[model samples]
Target: MTNPLGIVGAGIGGLTLACALEQQNIPFTLYEQAESFEALGYGIQVSPNVVRVLAALGLTEKLEAIAHRCYGFELRSFTSDQTLIKWQLPKNQLYYQCRRADLHQLLFDGLRDKSKLNFATRLTGYSQTTDKVALKFEHAPKVEVAGLVGADGVGSPTRRQLMLDSQQTKPSYAGYAAFRAILPWRSPYEELAGRATVWLGKNHHVVAYPNGNLNHGEQWLNLVLVVKESQWQEEGWTIEVDKSQVAAEFQNQSRLLNQILKDMIASPEPCYKWGLFTRPALPFWSQNKVTLLGDAAHPMVPFQAQGAAMSIEDAYVLAQCLQRHQTTEGAFQQYENLRYQRATRMQITSRKNADIFHASGLKAIARDFVFKIVDAIAPNLMNLKSAWIYDYDVTKL
Candidate 1:
């Protein structure tokens, strides 16, 4: 009998890959360090590109039930109460804004081989041979895998080991911090309740959209503030912070923006923040039988909101290659060849967006001028600009 494939994380990318493998009757085991799943993370956006993959994996009905479909966004200036760009998202393609924990549960429950999943199994290290890779967990005995996949996310031990052994660049801090808040979407903020909005400022930017809890019958709003702060260096990590402190960070913004930021956590619970980080797209994501996926391979800043979307795409494309190619070696190569360019482009463009979103002085003027021209000449240019990303259908690939 063949050894089962090893998946070293239960994140969005990891579980998605596992489900796809199970759908095809491919043997695989998932290792998760967390004792149990929790809705701990912040908001997550699912673009049309990833929705197509999820639908292909038989998650269409489930997503339709819980995912909040967002049609467009109104980009506003932080200093002035003026519209910068009114982008009407493409109609044919669907986009969903959701709680990360909610989406994680949906993916987790959809997996077929729960019997093969191991929780609280921290991946300590691994060793690879000619035909198999051996994984060492903190508690469990060493397990051999026919092929190894590292979906462990940024600061991945698997990636660190691979780069250390092969002499490659490690993941580095992206010089920004992300403050996130989730709270009830109630009365008084009617204008901000149901739509996605972006507030662009110098050296910082903010995004807010509607998200809800289907189980609890609650309406909520999700806010994320990305700012340049190099003084505190916390690499690839998130920590609990005071809600009042979070409000103060954005206190100088417009009245509406300030009110929304303050109300994001009106409850007693605290808010949280994390340092954003990334690594240059590796020249090769796969070496021998071991490979990297998702944030483990290409962690990007959140400017384009495609971090999870790209990871979902990676899983779908890799699964297709694995089923199509007879050998794991050829499948890995084909997967990288097909996916590397797209992932690299996403990483680079995400960085570019950080600069574009936080432009100041002459740069800001030039940006707004271009936006005005585009908004006037081509109102749907934003949709057309992202057609390559949204139109991607991995099932068709």
Candidate 2:
């Protein structure tokens, strides 16, 4: 029998890719560094672009049970406390808001061969021959497989080994970080039920939405507060910090902002902070029988909320490419060809949104004015502009 493909890192992207491959009867061995899967991460938006992918995997009904089906988006001015743009989706279009752990569990349950999972196996590096690739793990035996995939995330060792000299592999601080919390929902906030609200401020922005419960009985609300920082070199998502740090950053902002921060502080939950980082899109992501997917290939800032969506999209497409092409090299080439351009565009656009969302003074005024003009003249204009993002269906490609 042919050897199973080696998937490094069991993140959402890796697990999604594995589940896709399993559907096609493709064999794979999934390696995770952690000893066991724990409920990590605050919340994530499963945008319309990726909802189709989940449906294809026969996971839509399960997702619906545990996710809040968001109906639309609202962009508001932080200084003025005024709604700038409000747009809703058609009934057919589906957008979900849920805890990242819940989404991760959903994908994990979708996988058939749980026995293929490996734990406490930290990938150190890898080397590839003409036909097979060997994955090196810390204090563990090197395993050889027909192909290798790097879904190990931003600090991916697989990505490091694949492109040693490429400048794109290095990540630079994006001058900001996010303070995230998942607060239990006792009641609904204004426009936060079944909708995502973006509070745009000078050098900062806040996104809040209802996150469906994780069998904890009470519903939850997810909050991500992005603030500009002069110096913060660390990059991680699960670093716990005091809520006072978040309060100090936005103390001079709006009253609503203060209230939100107060509620976060009052809640028993802890706030986690992670520095935002970005890397240039790689001109190539695969070499020989080894390749990359998700943040391992292209890491982006969260300004556009497409970071996870892009990875999920990459997972399905890469699985398709591998199933179609007989040779691993051929499959890697086709996957890169189909994904590079679109993923690069997302990276660039996401960076641009950072500037747009954090506009100041006259630029902020102009930004609000443009959205107001579009809202009044053509309310549907926002929906029309985001069509390219939400309308993507990877199954059609």
TM-score of each: 0.95, 0.96
- Overall lDDT per candidate, in order of appearance: 0.82, 0.86
TM-score of 2: 0.96
RMSD of each: 1.9, 1.8
Best by lDDT: 2
Give candidate 2's total backbone clashes.
0
lDDT of 2 by residue, 162-208 (tens): 88856756877888888899787754365478789899989889998
lDDT of 1 by residue, 1-397 (tens): 1898898989999989998998888788999898976645668888888888988999987886776778787888877857878877766888887788878888989986688788889999999888889999998889999888899998788888878744456766788888888777666556764458888888878898877543445567788888888755554377888777777767654777788766764765467788888877787789888888999999999999999888888988888888888777788889999999999999999999999988999999898888878878887888778888888888887
Q: Per-residue lDDT for 228 in model 1?
A: 88
Off by over 4 Å in 2: 165-168, 188-190, 213-217, 234-238, 252-256
